[model samples]
Target: MIKFGLLWHKISLYASLLWHKISFCGIKFGLKLNISLLWKIWDYCNQATFNEVVYHQRTISSFLKVVFKEVDSNFAKLGTTNNSWFDYLILRRIGVETRAAPPPSMIEVHWWPPVGPWMKVNTDGSALGAPGSIAAGRVYRDHRGWVRGCFHFKRGLGFAFETELLAVIYVITIAHHKDWRHLWLEADLAYVVRLLNSHSLDIPWRFLASWKWTLRLLQDLRLQVSHIYREGNNVADLMVNRDCSEGWWPYALDEIKHAVALDMSTYSIIRIKY
Candidate 1:
């Protein structure tokens, strides 16, 4: 009797292992089917025994069977689905992988208008006292609608208004390089814009000395500076924030890199008129 009991125990262990193998096969088949691997699964199922098939159904086999049937039925109904078999497989794998994977790191990309005739310039500045760091950003867009380029500058700890003034200086320097005329410069800082348009450079005069040079440069090229709301200046703000980080300079003006990295399609480009 003891021998018989031992034999029964061994059989049970073997049965469990067999069941596990069959279940694994079924899961593999189901996953493949999601990716249009129906033929491969069909071939596998054909060679499987009734017991093995039944075992597969007992262990998450019902779930896989439902998935298989749903996918098969959908494919049959669609008749001419747009996706290729490889694409289907990749999408399915992505979905599964996404669920099992950690959340992806967020990447922020700024949008700037196109450059052409009669372009508008937008600029922004950021300063942090603790880090003693200051950064400025500027963007140029033409009337014909294309982003000419963006410029960013970082200086050691300075006043917030100083950073804003630096941004204007940077924009003027860019205009000089491109020989852009009839420019309309816009910034979110009201006081800075007022100071730029002010007749007398008051207490800010010391800081305004270098700005006089930039002002003379602007006068030589016929540039007009204006003040805009912060909300309207999001693009320049994005550039300034991103420039605060390391390694953002290389791809700063690369529209292609921005498009590819964001997974934006040609259609979006057309829609945005970029």
Candidate 2:
């Protein structure tokens, strides 16, 4: 009988050192192998090494899988017409073609009046402490840059998203009251826009009744919904939570007056996307 005692790592040596992949076989014996050989075969993160792990999925099998995957990726990137036997095997198993990254984009945005006979409504919400006192507002304007009417409401404690949804419902209710069927609605909150376009079940239970009523009123109107960045929607931001819920057009707030003038003149603001 061969002297197994002569072998440095008896457990790994018993595998007869699979000549084609000795390194791969060595990692399979990590649990009982010598510490020096185990160190070379497997890697451990800070959390896994000193035992600070919140992720409990780390194991010898997973480490070997990760190592082989990274090797497969590097060989795939080479994209050489004539690949070696190992490279060919890896590419065939991965079964994917390399692709180039898409280029970045830069866009310029500005508030534009609704075309033809349509009216424009911009709405926004604010909460000083997010979960603290909440308020919301909406402004109405026409193609001629004339303010028909506007309302700002300060309500009981609520989250900002709730305030945003409430603001949309408020605008819808008022639009029905005023019999404004042809309207273009805009908001700074993308969530509000998405909510309007999705099923009512997507909202919180507290807002379900209001959401249903809003959607019902919307069915009777020619409402066009869209999203605007806060920069372009600053007019609504400035008017929110005034002394009273009722506001009229006469250049009362100087900042709002300037913003309306800028939008009317078709001045643009550059929006950068990284």
- What RMSD value applies to candidate 1? 16.7
Write one digit per residue (lDDT tens) for candidate 1, span 210-229: 77777688666765667665
Give the Å shift of residue 224 in candidate 2. Answer: 0.7
Candidate 2 lands at a TM-score of 0.59
Q: What's each prediction's TM-score?
A: 0.46, 0.59
Say what the RMSD of model 2 is.
12.6
Model 1 lDDT vs. the true structure? Answer: 0.54
Model 2 Cα lDDT, one tens digit per residue, 1-274: 2222222233233222212222333353432333433453333333344554333223433444454444335444432322245434433443423232234576888888887578799999988785888888778888886677777778888889889988888888888988888888899888888887673558889889888888888889988889998878877887885655454443335546777888888698887774
Highest lDDT: give the candidate number. Answer: 2
How displaced is residue 242 in candidate 2, in Å?
A: 5.0
Question: Cα miss at 173, model 1 (Å)?
Answer: 2.2
Tell me, by TM-score, which candidate is best: 2
Worst 10 residues of 1 by lDDT: 265-274
